[model samples]
Target: MVLSSHARVITPVFSAVGGSGRSTVAGLLATGLAAMVPSVVLDLAPRLASPWPEWSSAPGAGLASIPPHMPLSRRQVHAAAGTNPAPAGAGWQVLTDHREWSAPPLAPVDAPAAWHQLAAVGGWQGVVADTAYPMAHDIVAARTAGRTGWTAAWCALPCSVPVVCTAATASGMQALQTALTAAAAEGLPVQRMVLALVSTGDGRLPAPVRAGETMLRPRVAAVVHVPYDPQIRAFGLRDATRLGARSLQASDLLVQAVLASAHASWGDPLPAAATPAALPPAHPSALPVPEKVSIP
Candidate 1:
């Protein structure tokens, strides 16, 4: 969607299918963006399924804890989400699902509204949301992508990208293709798809797979290759600072791609710095019209 540089961008990291390491990618993207700007990761998965710690359960935490649709300063966001040192003292924060066992689970339908409220809290350069795999009609990722100043990231194993190219004629890809087509038809624009390929080893795809990705390149806004590191799995998706050298480099590459995609997709560069401004009121006009923005 096309957004002015002043708008707050919210991106969702989702997988075409399960076991694609979507959450890991989302966390890395959030931490990476935090290095350049004030950013927050919002974990909207089911309570038990969220990978991040139950930070929302802390005193005065939870989505409800943040005032609804209010313009908050940068200090308020830092105080609410808490600060962590990553990318050398960059303030990255995370918010998770309501942790109270007695509390009713969040209704899927209310997700967009909840995210809107959180964005209104202000002081964020961007919000990276970790969405559950879309197996059902919820299509939360698509909903986020369709909004103005937002994008959707589809994470998958590195092998999966080649598989899409090599096995396009295979029946297995039918469901995935159909899903993607439907999402686009429903307003999930292609300019918003950050195709993140997570690698578990040396971060190299097979030659044939690489060619396949090249053939499929035009379908996505950008492709990021992430090296696999055990620490990511061991720590249950820790901060970027804890990543190893190769993994850290991969994270930086992925972040750079996302930022570039945001600039092109929104038709403006990433904001030079976070400013404390009120979020624009929600309306149909807020949805950006699709544009053919090229990704470098």
Candidate 2:
């Protein structure tokens, strides 16, 4: 299927210090986009492990066991589907690298090729990759060895590719800025970076912090703040995917605005209230809702 002019492929690389809610943001972004267009969410980080059963519980979520050395084909991916079904309008695939993180380097060539393959499947209009944090030096080395996967994935035309950098605090943002600066010095395009300020409290980003993000925005395609919501914890526990509907909505709006500002087509407006199918009703006694916890 041919991609729409609004097709946006993003690869969000989190910081090494994990637990900063990077995966949560990735999931929300993917779900949000799916509400609007055909999208694919790829989890590329090996360390942030997502259990298969939990993902399967969410409608439209599927797992694809992609070999590190092998390239995935649309048919191969479709064939990998098990009992879990894909969400409507989009699908989320968790690609695991069973090998040691350090053992299999991030093949630069495969990175971009994977995006192309995803676009080929289901005629994706957007692709969002949840990258691993503190990327191993070997991964960086592979990129240096002529792997432009990250660049190729986002640099596609008629698409607005933005890398959402999630930080716990301003200090974390500074450190990210430093690393991004170095990558720029090494010839990585810094202009494509967009900051997604994640608030750990009640999942709400304060106005002041939002303003602060704007102050430091770098060629910012758009700035998004993810409020600290308890439902994020439910990702593995229950079918709380709907809990993030609002967050996903906000994220989609930001992405749409970014694409429009870049002069790329924003495709058609999202369908009104397109919710993914709810997971089979679990025994209420089997899984009880947990008390809301304060955002850190």
Candidate 3:
């Protein structure tokens, strides 16, 4: 399989409806990518809804400190990112909030290219975003007066490889279908999207999930499952580095799937490189992109 250039930064998105384990998928993908190169996760979840600060090992300026509509330098980005404790965050970082309770949720991506602006910082090779949704709104929210300015209200840039997250349940599958339909309408390349099915329990895939995967198999680039790990449920991402072996394997596949996507997006030759954990082969599915959304 072709590898990444390891030269460019790509943000794989987990921008699905609430309760879809977006952060879970984003965190795993970031950690997996970090195993190869410097990587970070941009936590775009609103404060009350975010679980990041509780999971962080140290403290620093939380998301509320991000300079709105301003381009960030590598130092500025890292300063806001703070240090990630797991893996000693040797090669991984999270740009999220860590302030005390009662503070405000940081503003959304208010810049026209706010997400891209933050991602443009050069130190990392990949950025995984846990973005807010009802994307139709998020897409046009930039057009708002900023409550009164020419500036764009911050928002998530289009994902290089958008992974639609959902639980493996009948209801979850239904929401997944709705999200895909909505994403497609927003010009997102749903055909090239990846689906991360987070299992609700241990052992075999529930019949509903199996059926959902079968139905979506033909429309998306690939479908991967993230088995539920009690460790994470009990302790949050603070224990993510110690995920179960199968769960880790799923994360590896996730990383490969996105890498394969980046290679296709660039249509450039990518060579192989050693990785921390063995990864499964990249499916490398390149589907027809729609007319509206542009993924680069």
Candidate 4:
């Protein structure tokens, strides 16, 4: 069978508490993966009051705007996924910021209908649901429901689906564990859980985090560590479109590792070239370094 035939969708539910870098990571992951196979990166972040027409720093021009209760269609979601430059008159591009909305409940029923719409896209090989810390509970619940729905829709192979959680700091990891524990207590499938350690320029995990993992690691599937790069900070800008090629390359490496472990295809070629200009010099103190941690 072709790789797409055996394609397994991966849903990455990111923690908002990590800062703007999480969204950048999610976007880079999704866009990069989509270049190889059909994928979607759902920005569950909140919309700002006044959106930037494009990525700019003009004064008084506020953040982007999002609808309060709009049921998104598949096409709308796809449009959001694709590159759309900001109109000169519009001011700021519609950036994906999930924190703009008031925190919603963790129940599946409370989730935006847009999720279901995106799930229906063609090929729909993977989805990355990037969320903020305040909305982590709700995002996890919604992702669980999505996985369950996919299993139900495609009964032939159930274990093929997976959910990855990305956290900015060790505290964010704790919040994820609490949310997952609650999900397990509620009878949700916890076996598919993967803890993605998102180091936000902090190369090492906090001592308290290491201690908590000693107790929680056994319950998770795998722990993947991704270091933060200074280039990721540019995502906070108003007109941020393209990400650093090195960052994209790093994400591709993660995708390959995930696919290999899942027995998915690793030979698939990397996506097209869309490298941005050279990044501004980062402070010497900001570069990231890799760390080793025991996976339970």
Index of the highest-lDDT prediction = 3
- Tens digits of lDDT, candidate 3, 40-158: 77776676778777766554576666666544445666777754544444546787778767876555664335555566553565677777554434434533424422111221233
Residue 144 displacement (Å), model 3 = 15
**Candidate 1, after superposition: displacement of residue 261 in Å?**
2.1
**1-296, model 2: which lDDT tens digit per residue?**
22245344444434424555666666665555555565555555443264432454432323434433444445545444322223353444443333443554444333545444544553455556666544323236547796644433444433345455555475656555555554555554456555566666664455555555666564545566666666666553123345555565656665554444344333443212212232234635436789999998
Query: Tens digit of lDDT per residue, candidate 4, span 55-83?
Result: 23332212122223443333444444333
Tell me the number of clashing residue pairs for each predicted model. 0, 9, 9, 23
- Kindly report which residue stretches of model 2 are placed more than 4 angstroms away from their true locations once superposed: 1-17, 47-53, 58-75, 81-110, 135-160, 203-212, 236-241, 244-246, 261-296
| lDDT at position 200, candidate 1 | 48
Candidates 3 and 4 compared by TM-score, better number: 3
lDDT of 3 at 178: 72
TM-score of each: 0.67, 0.62, 0.77, 0.54
Between prediction 2 and prediction 4, the one with superior TM-score is 2
lDDT of 1 by residue, 13-41 (tens): 65556666777777676667676666777
**lDDT head-to-head 2 vs 3, winner:** 3
lDDT of 1: 0.55
